[model samples]
Target: METKIFAKDQLDEAVDLLAKGELVAFPTETVYGLGAIATNEKSVKGVYAAKGRPSDNPLIVTVSDEEMIARYAKEVPERAKKLIKHFWPGPLTILLFVKPGSLPTAVTGGLDTVAFRCPDDQLTHDLIAKLGYPIVGPSANTSTKPSPTTAQHVYHDLKGKIAGIIDGGPTRVGLESTIVDLSVKTPIVLRPGEITPEEISQVLGEKVLINTGKVSDKEVPKAPGMKYRHYAPSAPVVVVDHVEDFAHIPLNAETGVMALKSELSKIDLPEENKFNLGNDLVDADHNLFGGLRYFDDKKQIKQIYVQGFDEGEESLAYMNRLNKAAAGHHFK
Candidate 1:
């Protein structure tokens, strides 16, 4: 299969391909998502096959309008309605009880609940609206890899496996959406992203639950990224607890460092081996995945050492992704 790269204006081509049950990757503010119409079993299955994703790992349903949500979700409670009103078209994914058989087993992963997100990107909104149905969107990368933040990153992992990619440039968040499950009686977060639980609590005027514990492999996850060893590069990553910890290590060409620009200045590591994480939490979130991929491109970077941050609520999303990539490895 030839993977054609489509520009922002060429979504008509993308719509035509998707209608034919072909897979197309499109950008959201978060990351590029591998899109297959949720109603098409074959196309949705192709998404799992192409990405080598586990069949049991559920896919997110991306919608353009409230009508689509009403059509699929079993019941959108008052709290959920307020959340959608406040956070729709943003990096918040809500898990709700979906209508039975509304989507294929391939889409729901045979689960009764579905994850729904309405992205903030105009091009993606237009694509879904024009297609006239929701699409199953998983991060457009091979299973257990760093999620693709750019079209090139998608192409790097997917290439000829998919039909084409809609190049909407670099993603803003560089991480997946915050997934909160409303399917149960009490709402709880299954995954963390740019949207903090505190922010969600503020909008709903109720305290939100945030227990991001790693679900057991035997259990089917309610959300994506919850039961996978993800965001790893070719190199091993060591999480440095403090910036001054760099002084205890030996600097070499094969050793790479990912930290804030301020922290990078204090390390004696080679400029070529360092990837800057900017100066704050937001910047760190934006650059974290790119920094991992940057070392993969270098090839010779045998190991990566990254700076760790305080476990504040605002920094939870950044730390969640970083800890996953490092697999909870702290510097010795």
Candidate 2:
């Protein structure tokens, strides 16, 4: 199937296609999402099929606003309300007890709780509002691949598999949303994103549990991109604790290195084999996936090595994605 690229003005057409149970890839504040009407089982299944995503990996439902939560979620607790008031229309997804029979099994993965978020992007919010219902918007890429921040990335992975893609340029957050499980007594962060656990705790006037451990393969993931080795590129990625380590590591023509601009001169690799992700943490976060994709597209490069960042508040989300992309292969 030929995937059509829709402009911002053509969102009405995108909404129409979604209402007809066709998959439409659109932009969120965090990343590009492969969207399907959440209420339609067939459409929701198409998302998993198109992306080769695991059937059991639950998809997050994107809503227009806070009030729309009632249409899908069973009940909103008082703490959840506080979170919504502060973080709605941003990069934060809350896992709430879903209304029985309200959404398809394909959406919740047979779990009682459903993940929901109101994106900060106007185009996506308008698309959901105009469609008059929620849409399941997972990262618009093949399962276990780097999440697409640009529409071209989506087209490369899912061009013929999906119906259409709305090109809203690159995503601002450059990472997925922070997923908090409100279904439990104490809210636990299932997946970390732009929003930090400290921010959530400060807003709620209570401590939020941060679950940073990897989920065992035996357990079913409560959220998308949790259990799987996600955001990986075709090339093997190695994470090094310090940038200086890259100088000691032997390099060949087939190797590529992703490091900070300051560390690039220290690495022995050729200019083409080196990708400088700028100096700021935000710069690294914004270019993390794009750099991986860039090196992965180079046929000559087989091995990709990345410099690890500090685990500070801003860098936590950046490292989370990098660690997952490297598949925990870190060199001290």
Candidate 3:
């Protein structure tokens, strides 16, 4: 299929394709999501086929309003309502009990629960609002590659595989939404993103647990990033834990590196091989995926060296993605 790129005002084209049960990628506050009507079984399956995503890994139902979520979810608990009131139109995905037969097995991965997110993008909201239904919004990239932050990135990995793309420019938050599984008695974060567990806890007025460990090979992940080799490029990646560690790392024109401006200034690698992770952690979080994709475009890059941050509240989300992208390879 010829993948068409739609502008903000051209959402009617995207809605038309989605209405016909086609997979069209759309923008979100987080990353570009490969959208299919959450209720359309065939179209939702097409998303897995196009991304080569595992069938067991479920998708997030992206909606514009609370009413849409209510339609599919069995019930939104009082605590969940609080979270939705506080963080809706933002990067927070909550897992809830699914109303029987409300969504397709393809969307729930045959699980009893569903993940729902309302992104903080007017264009995305408008698309869903116009369509009058929610869409499954998984990162618009290949199964294990970096999540697409820009429409061009979506086209690069998914051209001809998907129907079209709604180009809402680059995503504001480079990482995916924070996924909190509230289907259980105790809430646990399945995936970390811009909204940290601490932030979630603050709003809920209770402690929230975070799942930092990897899911076992036998287990099916509740969220996308939990059991996948995600945000990785073709080249091998190594995480450098300290600024001084870069001195020990062997670098060359073909070796790609990512760090803060101060850190990049200290290195002697080729300008083309070096990607600035920005001035601080916030910038690092925003630039992490883009930096990986940048190195991916360079055919000569054999290995990538990235600056690592200590695992903490502010740094958790960034480190989580970097660690996965690097596959726990740290520069010793």
Candidate 4:
């Protein structure tokens, strides 16, 4: 199957289809999003079918500007405003309380809060702007499958499953956005991305609470990627907790290690049993899916082992994607 790469103006047609309740796949700074009108139930439902996602999982609404955000959310908090000024048109997603008549329940999974982001990519922004409505923008792939960072990745996973795909070039972040919930009095980091928690705190002058990684009944998540198994590949992938345990990886001609920056010297695996993405967390995060695709393309590699990151803002989102990509797979 061939993927269609659409120009910015061509995206208007996809937006037209979305207004008529059709699904379209497009790129964002974080990752490619499979979009449909958020208020239209059929459009939202079509997104779920296209990606095989569960109904209970909510989708983030992508808008073109701050004004559009106000149209959906009841109140965008003061701290949220500061963060938006710094991170808007980037990969930061702010979760705010949903207004009474703003959007359909389908977009929020019946929750009173909606996850929203104004994408930095012009092509994606134009699609939402042309539609003149918030669109349900979730990573364009099957639930738990690797999120598409490039248009070809979308076609690789969702070809013939969705109506059309806008093949923008590679995503800048190559991971999902940092999801911050502003509905509460204090800003909390539900999920971290390229925008570190330190950066968020610097802007707000208040320490942002990081989710304890424990699922509690009181927690009302605003986005689909949180506390969920996501971005997994077909083969088993494991994350190593200790560099010393690198040797414990089930090594052979078929096993491969995706190592970290400082720990590369610690890895003594055979050339064929190793693939170096980069040592830096930023590089590792960006090259994650691409490396997975590389290994997946290598027929001899049957299992993949990854080196886990120490806790930090940059590490948080990287770990999130890595953990999920290796979910139901392994730990070491």
Candidate 5:
């Protein structure tokens, strides 16, 4: 199957395709998502097949507004309401109890709770509203691969696998939404993204706990991108906690390194093998996947060494993505 790229003005065609149960990749503020109608069992299954995503791993349902969330989810708790007021139409996904028989089991991964997000991007909002139903939109890449930020990235990974892609340009946040499980008594952050736990706590006037523990093999992940090794590139990634230690690590022609602009001078690799992520955490978040994808696309590069950042509030999401991309291959 050939993948067609649609302009923002051509979204009606894309929505029409989706209404017919065809898969379409669309942009969100966080990343491009492989989208299908949430309530359509066969269409939802096509999403898993297109991305090679595990059936047991749940997918996030995207809606245009808070009003649409009620069509799929039930019993929106008081705490979730507080969070929705502050974080909706942004990059935060809330886990809520699923409405019986509302969504297909394929969408929920057989779980009783559903994860939903209302992206801040106007293009995606308009598309969803036009479609008039929720869509299950996971990151638009093969499962466990680095999430796509640009339409080109989506085409690179999902070309010929999906029906069409809506080119809304590069994503703004460039990371997945912050996922918090409100289904439990105490809200636990399942995945960290642009929205920090500190900010969530400030809005709720209470503390939100981060789930530091691992999910066992027998357990099903409550959200997508949780159970698997995610955001990985074709080349092996090694995380360096300190920039100065780049010298101690051996380098060869097949190796490349990614560092911040401030630490570029500290890296000992050849100029061609080094990529700078610039100075700010926001910039780092924006370029993180692109840099990894750039090096991975280089046929000569076998390994990629990435500089790590301090786990401060600003850098927490950045480091979380890096850590996952490295698959825990960290050097102190």
Candidate 6:
């Protein structure tokens, strides 16, 4: 359970363990993934057991390239092909109908579709190529917890539960890929991620369907992290409609504000306690977790007052992740 930080040379050992049906933590463009052989039902089950993930929430299959992914999917929709052409080897996961009996039931959560991605990170690609098959990789943390960015974070959450950890350093995106389901005739976005829906629409010439919320069970989801309470911290986080809502909150001497610099200046919070996460979405996206990590370190702060972003495709993915992290802590 002691997660070892494996180097490039040690990646072979990591793959060997995975091939033998043992779990290994490896890096991807989005976040570190707790991986096992996707085709091996027992190995895929280990991923669920290790992360305490539910069977109904499916796992994403990580492959080295587009061709590798084609084998698992029954048919590739035109929209999916356009996206793969434009964004493969990046932080984008496309859902396709599973080729009957090609992948184990566990990978699909018994659903008809499968989520597949070719990560941009070299370590993950190399690991997949070495293993010679797709790997079942969900974020390397317990279901509904903050996604791990580094190997240490993986160890912190999964130290005693997994077999090994391949330390690929911090993830570049620090969030999961946008999951687009192409199984339906019209493309539906099962999950929002770093790649915005607007960006996806530009490629496919159609609006992508946004998920109602992460915890909604209205329909079967195509990927992990959708059916759980996720990206949570130790303290309660409340998302407000505007800065004025801050006044009604009782100053219990344990609350702090997380907002844009412009909003932070307007608020009356003590300068020391005010958490200004950048003025715009780009910087805010980068600062989101760092702010949460800071709060985690402070420990004394009991409540986090988060401000919502204005509506736009650019802000959609960031807001989606933010809302989930807050987990029903939002105000109109």
Q: Highest TM-score, which number?
A: 3
- Using lDDT as the measure, the top candidate is 3
On the 0 to 100 scale, the lDDT of residue 260 in model 4 is 63
Model 4 regions more than 4 Å off: 1-3, 216-220, 260-273, 297-300, 328-332
Q: Residues 203-277, candidate 6, lDDT per residue (tens digit)?
A: 999877776754566666667656777777788888876667777776655787888898788777677667777
Name the runs in model 5 displaced over 4 angstroms. Answer: none
lDDT of 5 by residue, 109-146 (tens): 78999999999989899999999998998999988888
- Candidate 5 pairs with clashing backbones: none
Q: For model 3, how does the per-residue alpha-carbon lDDT over 1-332 read when each residue is reduced to its tens digit?
A: 89999988899999999999998998887899999999999999999999999898989999998988889999999989999999998999999999999999999988899999999999999999999999999999998998889999999999999989999998888888899999887789988888989999998888899896777988877878889788999998999998898998887778999999998998887789899999999888888999999999988999999999885878888988898999999999
User: Model 4 scores what on Cα lDDT?
Assistant: 0.80
**Candidate 6 residue-wise lDDT at 83:** 97
TM-score of each: 0.98, 0.97, 0.98, 0.90, 0.97, 0.89
How far in Å is the alpha carbon of 301 misplaced in model 4?
Answer: 3.4
lDDT of 4 by residue, 1-332 (tens): 33455666687677776778877898888889998888888888888888888777788998899999887788887877898898888988898899987787778888999888988888877777778888889999877788888888888888877778887889888888888888887778888788887888998899888875655455545677765677766667888877788766656788878886566656766766666768577788888877776677678777888877786555888887787788734463
In the range 26-87, model 2's lDDT, one tens digit per residue, is: 99888999999899999999999999988989999999998888988899899999999999
Q: Which 10 residues in a row give candidate 5 its minimum summed lDDT? A: 261-270
lDDT value, residue 291 of candidate 6: 68
Model 1 spans with C-alpha error above 4 angstroms: none
Question: At residue 126, what lDDT does model 1 achieve?
Answer: 97
Error of 5 at 20 (Å): 0.7
lDDT of 2 at 318: 85
lDDT of each: 0.90, 0.90, 0.91, 0.80, 0.89, 0.81
The per-candidate count of clashes, in order, stands at 0, 0, 0, 1, 0, 3
RMSD of each: 1.1, 1.2, 0.9, 2.7, 1.2, 2.6
